[model samples]
Target chain A: MAENYQHIQTAHCENGVVTGLLKHQGLDFMTEPLAFGLGSGLFYIHIPFLKVSGGPAISFRTVPGAIFKRTCKALQIEVVRKKFSNELLAQQFLDEKIAQGIPVGCQVGVFHLSYFPKEYRFHFNAHNIIVYGKENDTYNISDPVMETVTTLTIEELKRVRFAQGVLAPKGHLYYPKSIENFDKKLIQRGIVKGIKRTVNDMLHIPAPIVGISGIRFTANKVKKLRAKLGIKQGGLFLGQIVRMQEEIGTGGGGFRFLYAAFLEEAAEYLQDDRLIPISEQITKAGDLWRSSAVQMAGIYKGRITEQKDFDDAANMLYEIAEVEKTAFKQLEKLKFNS
Target chain B: MEKKDIPQDTSPLKNMTREVYYVKNSDGKYETGLSAGWVVKNEALENAWEDINEQVRAAKQAVLTGEKSPIYYYFVLQLMDYNVLSGYTGFWKFSIKKHMTSKGFKKLSDQKIEIYAKVFNITVDELKNFNH
Candidate 1:
């Protein structure tokens, strides 16, 4: 069976407290009272109408009085729930919105999470598919009313990348090479937190190998989804995204495994041995990586499952990375013309 | 039971009206007057007040009484053109009412087109005609 994890937490708001489950960074789990408003038994964050929103954290509730009555805000805490799924949380959230006129748009997508090893799937039935096999994974996930799901394969999901550069087409938003170049820089600079350097970093690899570029494209596609009715770009927003990288020569503990895979995949230029054992395949995940991409694509379509599933995929990838050196030689000879 | 001329769009409480006259098609021009109504009625839409009332009441009563189906009042509001104000369900009724009319529709429609043009850096004509 695939690996998984779940976290549930109970929050106390003015309207009362409810237990919620969250996987990723956001507060996606359902609240108590199952209602939407602070007054509706459910504790909901009080927000304004079209008020300018800041980045990852929007600061509000600073306002006092009636405006703060049932005011609510979502905070990320470990999930403590024993039961949470689409049939429960999904429908509950939908009903709450319709009844109270929350109208935060309809369910756009679903993202399933797994723990321990870490993996993700974007479609709703992804859990079922993995457990039951793809035999009966028949459902039009693209329906306007239902959300699409996405998946992740590793411990840490590479944020999606975009194409943008000098060679980028007129209408094309991002340049592929430029984006790849950026990922290489991240590896080259290399002093990263909570991550180790890999072969990709030593050789200075690109994105398609490591998976960030695919993510950017996936996010873009999610934007095109009609059901989500994606939010409008508030205004000309610009900020720096800071990423720490380790020094190239001192490829110590910090050099990331993802980078290593990139370097090995790029070794096609020479007669030297590339792909190592499936075990040492951590630097860059291969077919497993592709399947994760498919999973992520499914995520863009809006399906997500439990944390253990995400972890299983990640652990599998890590295992693929730890494989033997002789296997690498065999893989190197297997030229993929793609 | 057919309701009288769609009840002049007497929708319930709301904060922001998604129906704030934005165009859904790639064309970038809001469909105003009767065209907008037709789009909402058949293609896709949240049930309007009259719709909500009848559907909600009947469904609730039937659920309570264990009936097969509620008294489905299939009303015809196509001739009423009251759906132009359908967006008022989630917005401030007083303010949205002032803007959901003839002149208000044109002004908001133009502004909506202009907004997209600004973001995508295309022409107004391109935005409007593009959705087609």
Candidate 2:
């Protein structure tokens, strides 16, 4: 039997999957921004030693499953998550869950998902989607990134669930078993706590490769890419940053814009007008980040190699760091209505 | 990129769903948008694909010359770097690297081969005779 599952496309995967799953549980429908904000999805990290697709790692969001897990914890929602070592067992469990009328959110590799664009397929295994029903050999998919619902064969589904690489899905599955109407007061508290945690992460993390420091740290390395990695490798490395920011997880602007959207919605919900301007500040900062990626894309395409352009892009990051520092500090000091 | 500046990749190979990107507009807001295959974003992706393709091509060339083992080709096909493959297979990076060479690959014990085949999601026979 095909269970009724709503397919709502959103900019990011995990948050969208969470939103869809939560709504399917008869809980008040949640927006993607709210899910992201409650989950504290905003983050930044640039690991110089860790290579992703032949270039250093540059990530804009919290690690995979962090948002969904944290948001569920904060809301005190009854949810269950599991990781399977045996592919057959995982499929069996999924079938059992669907037979029980539960729509399960699954972590999958994007490379083998037949619905994805051919060019977009990579070894990224952290993509999240919903498996609501199974009809013979086909599983009904509610992939949050796709514009519409799709179906996958049992073999194709198994391949993606068992895909190997960093952050492999490991046939991970999660779903809410029980949900009640969320209290507005509790939601407000969750939002405020999420904001405080994000602010601290952006400003307080002592690691040089995380938070605002990481931005500047990456900028410094980017400036020396030509000298350190040589011309061709440096160009490719720079291109990897563009791919990470724009193509991978980001809807655009390295997820700063999405965070900005969350903040804007937060402002309205919290009834704190101050958050509106802070949201705009973050949006402006997101613009600058996008500009840097745009300039780096130019560098990758061999259009601009001038040190000045690289310098300008690095300088733009420095400026964004400053803007974020100020905005987050403002957010930290913000008072929510009790 | 300007709407007009986006590349018009009319090639039959272009995949519409993959080519589309979420981009920021002039007003500093992001919207799901399409890119002409020639944009810098697409170029970056193309560069990644090229690197992945090169690994596969090099593995095939090495197999043809009998310079490396079929394991090397499968490793690349699995989208794994040496470090990742080593970590999953419980072998040192150097050991994995050594196994890639024709001589070392031929000397593999069944236990080691079983571990590798399991990691790669292939049968032992498939790992041994991976001409395809």
Candidate 3:
């Protein structure tokens, strides 16, 4: 069963899981960008009250498990998801799925994953991987973020599945129950639905700490960070932003580039050249995000401590917020042939 | 970023795996590319580790001076804070705070000590007699 399962490396975990599982079910048109777009995965949120790893709780994509759930919903696929409080029950359930040759997606903590690099091992618990088969005490793992498939011992798998702290997996697993062929019209409709949802999320969300507003809110915080926290702590805060932006799963520039790629693909699928210009706009936004990261890195590295540097970084984010706002607004205005 | 301009700086993920990046090619079309690592991300990770190490060092010194318990040292070593430790052990924040003190830790029963040990993934003996 492991040999029959094809591993597809992706830029992010949830998107990869959605794409790989669908592809395994014979959805050949499925790609990372399409999964991301259809799932409305692009997002920006900085929870002011929450602190992760001594910094702000910042996420570049939608909440964990949303990509898989939303993508499957858009494609009208029946998804079976389960969570178990008992570790033994979880293992038994997973083993049964593997014995039936069904590839199952499991949510696990990154900290206990032995194959991950030591530096990348953190307390993040939303990472996703596929378990295609088992041999003795070892389970075959297809972590989308990795270049190749790996394996985890049964104990290791159980530990990660039941890892503690915030957003614990609790031995969660999910898979599409059955897949059926659909028409091109369904794909077009899914793309439009995804784009509309994303536009609303980025532009119309009422919360100050979400969507385009959240980017602006974070920029405002960045401007005041140095004065409020002083040089040492301020630099660490900026470093946290850079880490969240350019980390492995982001596909660079806090997923702006990935969103741009999605928009480009959507344009081709919808046969709407108008989306091409919007995609270019997103690409520019991604470039600005990269530049902002470089600016933040300058302060984090302690080479540039002046207030001006902090302001410059904040200004870049402000520009990004505006650019993303425009992109989403354009998406909102575009009339799709429904 | 442009295909030719995507950064490939050496980073902690050097020998582990190459990460995917979305970049523009010569024809200005979006495509997926692979990068070993980037300097900016590496710096952020290194900075985070530095902060964690600093906290661990402080916890060790506090434990050695009898200001904190072995549990406090293990908590910091495991990259956990009071909030996370409380969540893991199902202990109240104030209880965990109290347990971090040398006096409070000494008053803990074997059963309570075992809970902390399990959360830290260590033996009860290790939790009881952790040396820095």
lDDT of 1: 0.23
Higher-ranked by TM-score: 2 or 3: 3
Q: Which candidate is the best by DockQ?
A: 3
Better of 1 and 3 by lDDT: 3
lDDT of 3 by residue, A222-320 (tens): 999999999889889988888888888888889989999999999899889999989999999999999998898899889999999999999999999
Q: Which digits, one per residue and each the tens of the lDDT, describe model 1 over residues A1-338? A: 01221222111121111221111112332222121122222001212222111211111111111111221221212121112222334334333432432211111112222321111111211011111001122211111110122233321111111111111111111000101112222211221110112222211235322223222322232333333332211100000000001111001111223223323333322233433333244323323433433332222223443333334434443443334123333443444322
Model 1 scores a TM of 0.19
Best by TM-score: 3
Worst 10 residues of 2 chain B by lDDT: B11-20
DockQ, per model, reads 0.02, 0.34, 0.72
The residue pairs that clash in candidate 3, if any, are none
lDDT of 2 at B23: 42
Residue A287's lDDT within candidate 2 is: 70
Using lDDT as the measure, which candidate wins?
3
**TM-score of chain B taken alone, candidate 2:** 0.68
lDDT of 2 by residue, A46-72 (tens): 987778878989888888898998888
**Model 1 regions lying over 4 Å from their true place:** A1-284, A290-310, A317-338, B1-132
Stretches of model 3 off by over 4 angstroms after superposition: none
User: What's the lDDT for all of these models?
Assistant: 0.23, 0.79, 0.90
